[model samples]
Target: MNPQIPDGLRELLALAAGAGQAPWRTLLRPGDWLLLLCCAALVAASYPLLWRGGVADRAIVKRDGRLVTELALNVARKYEVTGAIGTTVIEVQPGRARVLSDPGPRQYCVQQGWLSRANAVAICAPNHVTLQLAGRGGAHADYDTINY
Candidate 1:
């Protein structure tokens, strides 16, 4: 069905479209544009600080789906974990940890490199080993899923 506009409303629309009056000025005033620019600038400056992950204070190691050990991030050291397949070597330094060597054929976890931020994780699927970084309070409660 065709919808019809009332005649008075149609005439008002036509006049506002410059059909029978001077050309219209923009609806936005200078103050409106200034407010919009300020809001955009604030968001741009704050986005990175708020979204970047927290500082990691320790590394949690797991093997065969069980907790193996927790290494403090304040001291540099290397650890070995026995997993389903073979041994996986982990290295830890101030505020970071990474899989230094893994028996997994793909070596994906070793290639993951340093995990400095809270909630960072590396998994050696073939060896059944996992390394996770956490802050003093542990993993962020707000995140639903984190990918490394």
Candidate 2:
């Protein structure tokens, strides 16, 4: 049997092999370091928000123009669904009820789930619906206060 080789295959192979021998610093530029730092800072800033429940409030769920259920949570659970008719389940921790609904395809709303604290939301895409938790209508005057 005869073996066929492409014209530039030898040069390409040599280049690839040489790459592994180069100093590691040659592969990382200043921009790469900056990007790594920025990502680290972003993750650091988000840790508290993601792990420590920021607030607490009542979460109301509605489906097809009717209220289905309500819950309270320390944080929202993220989920997704897609179909003609779909069901959304909301499980609240520390003594809360689960809200379920039938939503059509493009379950964007299901992705929004429940955010027990600030910067959290539940959304249903196909139905163009959302479920969220917020503070009571009145009686609050603290910037860092969280309602349990």
What tens digits encode model 2's per-residue C-alpha lDDT throughout 66-142? 56555555454523322235545556654222334535455554444434454344556466444555444322311
List CA RMSD, all candidates: 5.9, 13.6
What TM-score does prediction 2 earn? 0.35
What does candidate 1's lDDT look like per residue over 1-148, in tens digits? 6588987999989877768554334767899889989999998999866655477788999987799999999999999998888899999999889999999898989998998878888999999999988875446622311542
Check candidate 1 and list the clashing pairs: none
- Best by TM-score, which number? 1
Separately for all candidates shown, the number of backbone clashes (residues 3 or more apart, or on different chains) is: 0, 9
Residue 117 in candidate 1 has what lDDT?
Answer: 78
Candidate 2 residue 143 Cα shift, in angstroms, is: 12
